[model samples]
Target: MNERAPATSPEVLAAGYARCAQVTREHGTTYYWGARLLPEQSRRHVHAVYTLARLADDIVDLAGPDPGPATAAALDAFEASFWDAVDTGTSPDPVMAAVATTVRECGIDDECFTRFFGAMRTDLTRRTYDTWGDLLGYMDGSAAVIGEMMLPVLRPGTDAVAPARALGLAFQLTNFLRDVGEDLDRGRVYLPQEDLRRFGADPHARVVTPEWRALMAFEIERNRRLYREADDGIPALPGASRRCVATARVLYARILERIEAADYDVFASRARVPTVRKAALAARMVTSREPMRLVHRDRAALDPLGGTWVSDDPVVLLDDTGSPVGQAPKSAIHHDDTPLHLAFSCYVLDPAGRLLVTTRAASKPSFPGVVTNTVCGHPRPGEDLAEAVRRRARSELGVEVHDLRLVLPGFRYRAEMNGLVEHELCPVFVGWADGDAVAPDPAEVDDVQWVPWEEFRDDVLAGRRTVSPWATEQVPLLAGLGPDPRAWPAGARDALPPAAALGPAAEAA
Candidate 1:
């Protein structure tokens, strides 16, 4: 007999649900209303798609200032990895995994996902469409694919592709008209150029002119026609699915009505459908069931699986504590030469109360991964020596120790590693780790281990350990603290070092 567990873990499923629910509440009020009409299983899947899509949108839209290059690269990587996960049925990225589950469960067309990326890519560079055809092409990739993807989930084998595509385009175009001014402020223009030209309007010019009004009226009617065409396919959808689509259509359509009511003055201010109106639309959709015929149109050119786009390198998922199975420390040295002035040190302590010290990684740019004292750092501006040690210890070794009394402050050391000059004022602290396990965040410490204090001092003195300049300078001072210096290792023993052991110049240097 063979044993098996569930295909997806409960934790993963819960995470997916929470992510989707949060994103839906943030971005998809109307769509969320439609989602309620779905069966529980299908509803979960819809939310998953919404979560993934919203994340993708944020990568381009909300990432920091000057995000164009970074956003573009990230999107390309995400899209490539997304398709790879779909093809292979596994993904390291959580968002992609959720989307893959939705894809597999819903039997959605893969092209819809590709088109979504295509729309996102368009947002990266294109601000205006040259013609109605151009605008439709953008919508096909941006919005139509969403409907196509959902259709499979709503009705497994329905042939309503034509109607879904039309509806998606109609909804998207309406959104463009409504958000024209807002988009323009962000340096984007979604209105079709040919229509602008036809109405003697310049999209780049100010809003609310005679020409703009004419163009708005023309575009609104065009969307209304597309909406009518899309309605024809609604009855063809499964009963539950039709109502959901109807609610979305009616809700979006009101935006166009709002534009008209505003006297086609989208340039002065964008149009929006109020919540009360949206409620009315939802109610009307629930009571109405009209079957309209959809007219099929010539299809646009499909996007090719374009260039060989590279996805991001796989992320190694770790537990909440940031540990991976069988992981080992990666050694490297830190030297400060760059504008950021970055440097770091690691303290290795074992369960036997010994500290293991090693040279930094040879590949590092700073100290070339130099061997260093138990703790090290660059004294940040406005940070005293004691404060710096606390921050570095906690951040590098995940050991939060307080009562950091500085044994020696103002001890300056200099060394050159990998063409970078390292100048540091060594401030040594004796602190105690209160039974806290060391959890090294990889971006800093590479390896750590505890070794006997006597052994560590001998290794440094004998040159067996390639100690950093600061560490080399501090070892003798640390050793002189007691008969068995290991017994007083920094944070452990409470008694302070005798004040007479060092001159004021050495102590305060």
Candidate 2:
């Protein structure tokens, strides 16, 4: 558990947030645990906003003694008072006080609050939505606005809003899926009526019938797509904020897994992710090398180290023909055991035209302590080879490369070291470093040094230095081309092997 050291603030603001934070922790277990991944300053603000939303929600749904009209009137009054307090920069109500402080401090837009309350007002009268678009209209205000509100705390790029909106809708839809039975008990069905009819599902059919199962599966797939779309924007955020959002995304999405585990019997039992599992997931993020990688895999290509080095991370599994047949956890790939896959080797050169070389960390499973090119990486499913080269350079060496040129597209190799095999139809790239200093990530490289290209070639040829078998063939071939990368012979740039040509013959060669 992360401990927050007490710091003094304006008494009213601090007291307001303290109360809101407690409310957040007590009710929203999954969100509370995920928010804990954020820095205390941002975390408190998130709690305050969530508390404000939760309070309004309670007024609409949990004002038990009041009828619908009374509840609606109460909600309207609460909104009016909350906004008035926000405008005046003070609120006697504890929740509003926290909300005011958070909005002012984080520079949140009042328009976001306007949109959120609009959705809350809808819940009063709307019993059933007719189409997917209508539900989306409802969620735009209800769910998407929440994502918009939190963007300031997350601090992602301006382009982040679209994905943030998708993620919010995904989270809200997951709740709808999990709470189907509970929602029914409250005389409501959150799933769109049109979708229900399209799938031959009857809202009144309380049992998990086959039609209902099919419908749930369809909706689950839809939600998964939304989650993927939302995940694309997470990396644009700051590091800690990315982790916090990623943590929340993974844990919340796991509820769908729970529902599936129970055979889509969300009605019989509400899918709940336990607090212990939530803690373990958060702990895993802390220990994992690339914590910024989000819950979704397709969007993970943008993450520098998302698919490399880490065993459980997924890599594109290619058939002998170099076409992506599927993906496998990287840990599952072993020497000669798994089919040959597509990979890329990148070499970086300083302004002086010196090539960077790195020793594989001793802890690496294969070729440990062997020297290699600046870095080697496997492209995620559908990732471009040149893009992968640049990604690995940044992740492993903490350096950026410009104008990566695929110098040897037909490069392929198969070598066995210790018990593991090295077989790849790997493309070779050359890129100039953006700066002189190379900061090596210790997990990936044991040591890094820049050596003149000619000197490195001579050392490798003379057996004065140990190099990975792929590099053994590659470095000398690169040296044959010459000193200036831009001036390298055009003949050296072979066309990449077509998918059909990457067969066992290439592997055995």
Candidate 3:
């Protein structure tokens, strides 16, 4: 090196990036180690993005509950400064300069930051979130957009966008669960109030009660579901980027496991993956082929009813917004903490106006050996729910359904049978098999019966006879339509869930 570059040369950019890296290392060890596997240029861009987010988050969060007008003005100034640097491609502030450079080099969209800063500003005054949907609204801006910002730098295929956003949401949700007590001190509640009321959990008590455990179990499973969503996109990345993201995913997901291992007592102690564990994970990711697979697979084996990887054809998984976040094997998703999924139930009718019901095969998984609706099953990925109903009716009962009218377009429920939970956004249907004989497949149905619709409805309503949880809930609603099953009005086609609004209309095939 005959001559060193002046500070006015490329060294200025290098210094900014170096400073960004130092900030990342100090504040975000998870990110710091994850980015280490990326190529040099890419790694610096990642650090710059993290530094920008970290600094912005500090301005909002560190202001305390009473942020007042001053906090908003300060945040506005920080954002304005960043944008000015972005437009000019330079800044006196080292972190802003590095971030602006990364944005210019990677072509990161300014809209992502707009949404992110909007969300940060929301935190200034918003004290609590009312529902899962409401909370996701905030997370979409604060967390999901950050993933969007990172996508260009990570340089995976465009298909990875949804998964990347899912990873962002998953990471933030984990942080919320782990830091609930800390968040309480800051006058924030990231957990949905609806979920808290449903489980009767009072996090403020800082005690590990049964309600809190149940609530955390539901949330942790949801967090893991997002991780699975994110995993779908990892293989799309180039080698080192894939390794870096995988390492980060596994390490972050492990925090959920830690919360579980500590008996869901998050308030008692902050759950974490130790620094040594993080370093070891990073090392493993570097040397291993398919590092993500082994960690998730080992964790899946811990599930009481196996894991959500039982088939090559995956079942679609939905978030609170009813969007397809990812897909998983149908066989493994119906355990005690079953995540939300798409499915349908059909009531088969004969010419004599009798509703066909069947007792499930004893060996079958989930609500087995119980008398329920004529047919019920998950729609295979890309297969319409109406098509699924028609398919399931044939395979399970050896009959083809005609007049498959969707009777309940928005039916959802959570029920337990023998401690195994079944949950689904199952649309209800009414169809007739016409002349088909009552031939039940021994593998799917133990017995079949055709009871008058009124009798079955009254039986369930009066509790004189027991049936599947969905059947019990459905019969009452089905009865509300009319006396004659054939005369029941079909739900409007447009009322179906978005993913289900596909294939042929709810008409006779």
| Full candidate order by TM-score, most accurate first | 3, 2, 1
Give the per-residue lDDT of model 2 (tens digit) for 1-509: 11222222478777888888899889877778878888889999999889988988888777432237788888889898787666766767766867876787778888898889889887776777888788999999889888989998889965799989988998999999998877776667789898798668986678888889888877776676677668778889887787788888888888988988899997677799888999998887776666654364423223222224544556666666666677776655643234587788877888887888899887676677888888897877666666667778888788988766667777888886543566788878777885678888777789988888778888998999878899999977887778666666432332664431221111111
Q: Candidate 3, which ten residues in sequence have the lowest lDDT sum?
A: 1-10
The lDDT for every candidate, in the order shown, is: 0.60, 0.76, 0.82
Model 3 Cα RMSD, Å?
6.0
| Candidate 1 lDDT over residue span 102-200, tens digit each | 787666777678778988888887777887678778888777887788777778345788888888888788878887766766677788777677679
Query: How many residue pairs collide in each prediction?
Result: 28, 1, 0
Which runs in model 2 stand beyond 4 Å of their true positions? 1-9, 63-67, 292-509
* The candidate that achieves the highest lDDT relative to the unseen native structure: 3
Q: What is the lDDT of residue 351 in candidate 3?
A: 86
Error of 3 at 60 (Å): 1.9
**Cand. 3 Cα-lDDT:** 0.82
Model 1's TM-score against the true structure: 0.52
| Model 1 ranges off by over 4 Å | 1-7, 63-67, 84-94, 156-158, 267-270, 283-509
- Candidate 2 or 3, higher lDDT? 3
